[model samples]
Target chain A: MTLRRIFSFLFLLNILSCKTDSEILPSISKEDIQIKWPDYFPQPEYNFENNSLTKEGFYLGKKLFYDPILSKDSTISCGSCHQSFVAFAHADHKLSHGINNLQGIRNAPGLYNLIWQKSFFWDGGARHIELQPIAPIINPVEMGETIDHVVYKLRRNNAYKSLFNKAFMSDSITSQLLLKALAQFMGALISTNSKYDRYIQNPKMNPFTDDEKDGLALFENKCSSCHPAPLFTDGFFRNNGLDSTFIDSGRYRITNLPSDWGKFKVPSLRNVEVTYPYMHNGRFETLEQVLEHYNNGVLQSVTLDPLLRNGIALNNTEKRKIITFLKTLTDRDFIQDKRFSE
Target chain B: MQRQHTLIFIILFIFFKMKSILKVSLITLIVIIGFSSCKKDRKIDVNTEDPSIDKPDNQEKFGTVSIVFSSKAGNSDLELDSVKYTNAHGDSLTISKFKYYLSNFKLIKDDGTVYKQEESYHLINRSNGKTYTVELENVPVGTYNSLNYLLGVDSARNTSGAQTGALDPALNMFWSWNQGYIFLLFEGTSPASQSFNQALSFHIGGFTLPYNCIRSISPSFGSQNVLVTEGHNSTIFVNTDVLKMFESPHLIKFSQVSESLGGAIGSSISDNAANMFSIASIQN
Candidate 1:
């Protein structure tokens, strides 16, 4: 080719190489992360601002999430506590770890498609997904970093400067851009394709085992009130016959009242198989121990939910069945999602 | 060098696009002003007469009201029980200071029209005085019939997340774990204990079920028809003397109040403490 034509050809290549502009999705896009949930699920309380999915924003949030720059000494990151392998919950530790090996007051809930959550955390403290990260970022025992400080540091970084520019229209790292990106990632972490979902969706094709069926029945009768299936939670805080005196205070921490003492948000059991050592404080070491607590060890308190006040009665065979049912909540698809892995 | 040129072109394009947006906004603003003036009095017969002719300064006339808050604690003006900080049994219980949240505030016009405050949720530090004060601005020169304000931060902002300045959590008004904000910080000793003898503080708030604390307060002193302008101060006050907080079956004692009973404590103290702070406490 002639030199002039070669130059023209290069120009055309650049134009062709440039992918279509990442326009705001009119609906969930192929690149747009999908939020998997069952059909029986209620319409999400969080309204998407006209299908507000963006790749740049989600990736930036993911990068910031894994980066420790959000911490005070740049030591700990959100990933420090919320590792993906453990379903975004603090693995093994009774309490979440933070900056300088600091311990948090409550166990960090596994991060996921929180747009459906009416409330967040064990105490139901965080009302909005966008605002939830601010708690960990600023909590003294958590990251111990202020939103403003995070914005300032991101503004100074060459990497974040480009990342913020791609995520937001401007490189100016306001709280809005930072939060929007985080919310994008959090809202997109949906976990729906479990064996239980498949079994329920197609009862005949993907049959549940006899043991699993028995477990399901037991779960429906005993655990359905609080740990309602589908979402696996009713989204209300309850004492669960945990204690009489308010050690953690649970929901009562937000309101200055007595009735809500020790009440905590009923967590969804989507990945209970892998997310072991359950309960608000990570007090129960095994699933069997938790079943025993529900079966007979439930502590009596004034605020305890009446349904669970008597403790869920079950035989040894029934307990084994319940464990099998609980295992069905695991979504290996989520654990293996390329989008979430480090 | 070629890649650098491409980046430069893209950057310049974005800059030009932003400038175009600014230019469009400016043109729209001029058009709006032109249309408004043209539309306001379209059929004027050389302006027959401006009603202001008879009362020359009537249209420009302004009046001021100073609000005073006094509670019937047997005759003393309703002041906070004490200026002492918090030291209840719970360490999270200590309050360095107390502040009230008021937002989306609007002054109702006598003509049923509303003149909204530029920054509606007015954060008045009651610690300064029994009376919280604000000056009305660009009010379209009207006689306002009354003042109306949300007793706490609006639900929109509560769910919106980590706001700064007056809404900053450094104010200690925010609960980091539980997402909702504590609208009122009532840090006073309850007569429930003997450790140094003080009342327990009731940090009453929670904008959710079983304990929503968002309240509406119109100074019970009744409406004051006042004209406002670019240069005038409006005073609003609140009285905590209602004896309403203790009206509940359970009395709040400092010895018993802990962080554990957080949002639920709202029901006991909200009715009394919600109206405890007044907007118009003095004449400005």
Candidate 2:
């Protein structure tokens, strides 16, 4: 009778122990979310085969993007320079601000629709988006953090350990995985719900006003050769005749070819209204200034775009009409969307 | 009272037996789970390093081949900052830094079949002064007579995204401004140089038209085929003469032209890289 009592007590204890362990540490499971991109947009340049899209990875990426832990002094994040409110552009700063109050040489380009971009930055130095974070993270004037240190910091954090386990099914954090997570989050930031997008989807649903219509016509005639429709960028480097004596040699710095001098990448006109302070150096403060430059300020150089050589013949009324058309590109739904907000 | 006691004893006996059985199974389950989880972690590590680990089906047998790179200026071993080197153009130059990318290895079997190493990229930096030996594992087991390799990152990988191992951007072998690898870098001082400090730096790399600086070399083993048998180790010794960089087709003088010639100097140095390498020894 004594032996039987001992055995029965042990059985009860064993079951209770298992139950308590389960209750104390609940199972963490995350669902995989599909990336939603508009049908009109071209196929993304990034191949998803290497790192498949997963919900846990996206959320982890979003958290990392917003967190200041990636910075060297823990003062800045990718989000600091790229805010969600202004379509991820560094708003009013002509030269994008960096860590320790340092300034970058180029303007902070917007972050959405990046999957379609073959390269990154104003000069398009970074070939892949997965590699793009390395530039800002290690740039001495930027976040100023080493990839090894960032990985070490993430490994030390308890929350990140579990998050990485859930996302990658392993607690071990690596730079490749970190970059993959960043790519997942950045790739998911697809903006295809502007008034223009709706008009493209169904013209009757959201028709453009008369002023916008005139502006679109003028833009098609003048600007569409460089800033094509849909993606809004032809994805080529051109010297838009911004300067004759190249302070910043632009593509020439990369290619080292004299012909590529002053040739900067043709930027997309999407979200142009909100992403103020335009061009590679962010020299123009307003749309009017940009038009005025194209109209008169074009300095002739050997590498200048032949299309803009004669200058874009635009008067005050035409500039206003073009500005109204550019305003339609501002996607309010994307900027105010809570999915990307901190 | 006697009948109740017998019934209680029987019930207690059954409960005891059931408890023992449950406890034994639980422990076994835990042991199995613990072992499997450990194995899963190890597998993840191996998979990231070698993707071929998962798919062993229809795989060929392979062995490892290690290549050692030794730098020399003429007949003597390279001594950085020694100021004891002379170029073809009769200029005295002292090499302070030397680094280059050795990639895209191809093994030529006795039957003339070629086998390319997967993810074959290595950066050789003399400044770090470590063993410049790179071990290429999982090469198909066979007799290889000659091997061909490129001195620069290919155009395909230059345009591709972030790479791992030696090609990792963290290694600092890449040019931040140019979207390409610095195929060969040589920095030193010369009395005849135009710079204030008499410094000479040449960074040779470009993938664009008219200046594509990637160069390849194939070194043959005389009268012997390198046997790469399964479980057998092999080493190939390749000697590099830094003099060849400034000699032959283009005689680069420190006084005439130094510093980053963009692609101008790069083009000539790349052409001369073909004659810079020779196989010293191959042991099976």
Candidate 3:
């Protein structure tokens, strides 16, 4: 080759190499990270802007979520309550089973599409997603570990040190970084591939059965006011008139308002099939019981929802049809996804 | 024909050897250039250096100002969780918890120039007696006549998202439900209190309008200024009287009014908190 051509060739090679290097850079590339959700879904409340999501952070958080080292006794992990199967909800257990078989007061809710949730917990105590893990970690019955102790333990471990180094670019393992890592993992759980999601995405591709269609119509007319579509929750606290008097003040404990008595967050109905024993206290076992309560068993109270004042007028056939529609919300892919499992 | 073939082969072999050498030299040059360029692009990586006990301040002519908080009731030092003192209302009291947030620290110069510490939020607890003395580093070298501080967590910090260090909600100073800091927490048992065992609990904090409880306090040093110079260590002794909390604008009798959860009583406590502290001594 000529001297001029050789110079040109080297110049071209340098440009090509630089381009390739930039592509493989370790910085969190949002383009590479795939957060799967149907187009019909609204913008996530957690945009992952403050704590940007990275593959390394997600993996580290996954490990932390499953690892019992986060607990005081080194026996209970977050996954002990929020398992991947049954849509991250502790199935069969009405109330959450904590460390040393200690029973928690409330049912452990399913953990998917959490990025959309404005406030965490049934009572809506934790305002930020980053602050949510701290509550469980120090709850005495749950993980039973202090934030400092968890950081201290993680700092000493070689595996966690390397993971932290990769995730946060620091092996110091600060509480902020630890919480952020957990948030990344929890926020990545997007459950939008159920039969309902498919039907919503393309009305013809995944056609609903006649019973499911009738149930969906009934659900839209009756339940859609509180348990809305797309995300399956309006994200508002309401007194569904489950009881005349509440033992657990629910949202009232957080708000300290008389009107907020017996008010609990309208939980997302997605994956509600496997995540049974519903409600803030897990009072009801089956969807039939839940339907039966709404149909005729709703008690009158001071803070009872105006929508449920007259009670949902549903016959036995209509209730069965509604139950069938609720089953379509069960996302099998989400529960079996190996990405979240131990 | 064999001689011609051999000559051609020799020339070809020499040319191939020279090309290989050139390729090796070019590759070496590229590697050197690549490394040098990579090094040139500043990598803002983690501080891999050992954690320092004292953070090295890069500012010029700055010194540390340590403020010592001493809780007092009348002549004797107030002991926590033990009934020892009487309030202004002649009520025998035992304070169990006397923790409050102090923030927006400012050092007022003789000329009225203020040196405000950025993000200066400190949780002072009587339970943790050792932490009562808050050491403020990197204070500018100057003669400060008065030191001003807010007795509560500011509305800005309260509304902001999750914070770390002293402001972390995990520290137990933050109110998870109200979404604000419990700025002044004074829990004790008084003989005049109506509750069981004469328990007088005051969780005074609210950052919203109509109940905003943030109080700014500029302690008077009385013409004697705190001198801050390079390498100079100084201690500003501040005396805090819990008795003052019950007195001043709002005469809160333990028997009549004890708990100030979040209304008018909470707002008035901030006013009382302002008068609760007095500058005792400033040693340079």
Q: Best candidate per TM-score, number? A: 2
TM-score of candidate 3 to 2 decimals = 0.80
The global Cα lDDT (0 to 1) of model 2 is: 0.81
Model 1 alpha-carbon miss at residue B189, Å? 13
Q: Report the C-alpha lDDT of model 3 over A87-168, residue by residue, as the tens digit.
A: 9998888898778989889999999999899888998877777778877887877878887788889889998989898887
TM-scores for every predicted model: 0.69, 0.82, 0.80
**Which segments of candidate 3 are over 4 A away from where they belong?**
A1-26, A29-33, B1-37, B43-71, B74-83, B106-116, B127-149, B155-162, B174-181, B187-239, B248-250, B255-271, B278-284
Evaluated on chain B only, candidate 2 has a TM-score of 0.78
Candidate 2 wrong stretches, greater than 4 Å: A1-34, A152-158, B1-64, B127-131, B136-143, B222-224, B227-231
Per-residue lDDT value at A165 in model 3: 89
- Each candidate's interface RMSD (Å, one decimal) is 14.1, 6.9, 4.1
Q: How many clashes (backbone atoms < 3 Å, residues ≥3 apart in a chain or on different chains) does model 3 have?
A: 0
